[model samples]
Structures are given as structure tokens and as C-alpha cells.
Target: MTRRVSAIYFLPLVLAAGFLCFFLDQKINASAAPAGFENIPGRILGSAGEAVGDTLFLKADAYFHGGETFPNRPPETKEELGREGFVEDERENEKTLPAQPAGDWISRVNHEVRRHGHYHLTKDKQKEMLPFFAAAVKLDPRNVPAILTAAFWLDKSFDRSDAAIEILKQGARDNPEAWEIDAALADIYFYRKKDYARGEFHYADALRKAKSGDLTRFRRIDLTYHLAESLNFEGKRALALEAYREAFSLYDVENQTPLKETIRGKIQSLVVGE
Candidate 1:
């Protein structure tokens, strides 16, 4: 009888332990399940956003080029056309061929109804292209090409250097590791804004990042040369000479004769100036 009572006590303890373990396991799984499921929706939305961004970029590119065609040739200068034996009439044809404006279905229908069989010149195509690039960046903030191209047009075509600088600053924040952003910043500061100090700062940073990344030797040489120029413009003759010498060292003496000569000229000029 005593042994039977002991057995009954041990059975209740075993049942309680098993129930506790089951409850803890359910709690653990309940906590983890929500986290896993939450990521699924986020991943889906991110992919959809990237796809929409791509579509907007394509539309913007079509507008920028004024058509949908492979290998869009840039508008030729008069000198280039003359060299190519193109007469004035042929040179006129070198301008962007007019095309229907790219837009949503409703917009396309409206355009067709309002101006059927009539072509309009895309003289303000760059301005019209800005909205799409802006929307693309809103959808996908990581769109580097859209950011860079928009900045280029703003600064070069629109004479909006401040706006371009702002956009590039945002891009640099979003993509800290992108050496191209720093390079663009350097160019704008050096050439457009005439802030040689800021230009030197960015160029040095860009060169460091490029060396750490996969930038080609030729490109690195270009960056170093520009860095030297920025330093020279800032009147830091000693540092400029050192940077120029570094640029010269980057050239392959036998194979890159012209490049070596160019860098050597820069180094010698700086040395003579000092």
C-alpha cells in the first residue's frame, strides 16, 4: 500500500513537469512566429518598391533621350558634324528625334486626344525628366544612377549647383561607401563652387575609398591627379607635389608612356613653381 501511494505521487510530479515544458515551448514559439511573419511583408514591399523605382527610372530615361531606342547618340556639336561630313540639314537631323511623351495610360490617352499626329520638340526634356527621378528616389532611396544623373542635369543643364550639391549630400549619406559620390562632390566644389579646401577633403576621401574598393588603376590615377590639382589650387605646394609624385608612380612607365609623361609634367611644373 505504501509503495502504491509513492507511485501515485511520482506520476503527478511527472505530469506537472511535462505540462510546464509544453507551455514554455508554446510561449517561445509564439514570440518567434510574429518576428518571422513581420519580415515577410516587409520583404514583399521592398521588392515591389524596387520594381516600381525601376519602372520610373526607365520612363525618365525615355523622356531624357526623347525616345525608346538602343544606343542613343548624344546631340552632336556643329564641329563634330562638320568633321563627319554632315551638312547643315544632316546636322539638324542629329537632334533628338521627337516622340510621344511617356506617361500613365490616362495621360497617354489625353495626350493623344489633344495632339494627335503632331510632334512636339522635347526642348525641356531635362526639366520634365526630373519628376520621375525624384519619384524613383522616393520609392528606392538606394538608386545611385538616378541620384547621380539627376544631380548632373541639375548642375550642368539647369545651372542649379546648390540643388545638385544638396542631392549629392543626401546620396552620400545614404551610400557612405560609394566613392563616386565623394568624387562628384569634389568636382562640384572644385570646379563650380570654387571651394578648393572642401574639394581637397572630398577628393582625398574618394581616393582612400577607391583604393579600398575595386576602382581601376587608371581611374585611381585620375583621382590622384585631381587631388593634386585641388591641393595646388589651395596653394599647398608641398602636398600638391607629393600627390603629383604619387600620381606619377601609379603609371606603368613602359606601357603608359603618355600618362607617365602627363603626370611627370605636372610634377615638374609644381616642383619648378616651388
Candidate 2:
């Protein structure tokens, strides 16, 4: 009779244990699902998101630098995709792009790639940096400082002028009013493209806006002089003389001209027969 009673009590206790185990297991699974299920996919998505986010932020910050929100993406790519296939350009584009927090996405991308690339460059690790720098420049073309920095460290960096030109062209499109962009374009045309007329046009375009009354006051020295040089090279002695004269006049205003006398001397040699 005693043995039978022990068995009855022990059976209930065993059943209770099993129930407790089941309850605990269910709770653990519920808690683990969030982190466990999303562990790998979340990381991948996060990385892709960060890459895209940073690129958008950089471009936004570059153009709308007043701490304004980033602009929406351009429509050219949308149209291109539409032409490629049956992908329609609608509000549904957001379906593919993840939502973003507020900020300059392009600038953020520049900072990210620059940070990673700079570190690698310092360690003399070109293999580690070239691909990253290429991607950075490709995505954040307006970030010329980043490109310049990486180019300074890379071997035969001048070879990347094509890359710089591509970015600058985009910058020109986005920031048409910026004289510096015009000047940069001129530099590329003159120095890299060997197209003096186009290059001269860029410098002249910059000069139209360069109200700075001094050579030192101008944004860059090379642009100021090169345009003059191009004039002389293009057989426009009259215009070249005028440019040098204006350059000197600008220097006279600030007492900080860039070798005005040399430029004046050049004018004499060209105009009056040295």
C-alpha cells in the first residue's frame, strides 16, 4: 500500500517536471528568435545599408551644406532602369531602398571610405586600399579632398585623372554655380585634355565670377596664370597681355600677388619685344 502511494505522488511530480521544462523551452525560444533568426541577415543588410546611406549623405552635404536634409536621389538612373526593362519609376522605388535617418549620406560615405583607406595607405598597404579608394571615389565623386588624399599616397596617382574628371563632371552638374568646379574643369581640360579652348572657357567662366581684386585673393594660383598662359599659347597675344595686366591689377589691390612681376615681364616679352 505504501509503495503504491509513493508511485502515485512520484508520477505527478514527474509530470510537473516535464511541464516546467516545456514552458521554459518555449520561453527561451521566444526570447531567442529575434537575435537568433536575424543574426547573419541583419548584419549583411546593415552593412549594405550603411554603404548606401553614407554615399547619399556625402552628396547631400556637399550640395546643401546648411545642415539641411539630404535630397532625394536623381531620376536619371530611374529612367535608365526603366528603359532597360519593365521596371517602372514610381513611388515604389522605396520598396527596394531601406528607409534612412536624416543627414548627408554622401559625406558620411566619404568619411567612412577615407577613414578605412587612409589607415591602409599609412601602413603602405596599397593592395588593401586601392579597391576601397576606387569605390569611395566612385560613390562619392564630389569628395575631391578624399580623392586627392588617396591619390597623394598612391603610386602614379596622376594616372587617375580620368577618374577625377568623371567625378568633377558630376560635381559640375550638381553645383553649376560653384566657380571652383569650373576652375577644376578648366584644369582638367588644359592639363589633361590638352583642349586649350575648352580649358580657357572654364577659366574665363571662373573669371567672370572672380570678383576677388587680388591674385592671392583668387581661389587658385594656377588657374589665374594658366589662363593667361593659354591665351599666349593660343596666339592671342592681345588677350594674354590684357590678362597679365588684370592679374597685376588684382595683386596691386592686396599686396599679395603671385609673382606679378614675372607675369608682367612675360607680358613685356610677348607684347613689346623683350
Q: Which numbered prediction scores highest in TM-score against the true structure?
A: 1
Q: Please report, in order, the local distance difference test score of every candidate based on alpha carbons.
A: 0.72, 0.55
Q: Which ten residues in a row have the lowest lDDT in candidate 2?
A: 115-124
Best by lDDT: 1
Report the lDDT tens digits of candidate 2 across residue range 176-263.
Answer: 5556666776877787768888888889887776556533454544566778877877878888887877766656454644486688
Error of 1 at 167 (Å): 0.8
Q: Spell out the clash pairs found in candidate 1.
A: none
All-Cα superposition RMSD per candidate: 12.8, 23.3
Q: For candidate 1, give the lDDT of residue 260.
A: 72
What does the lDDT read for residue 115 in candidate 2? 18
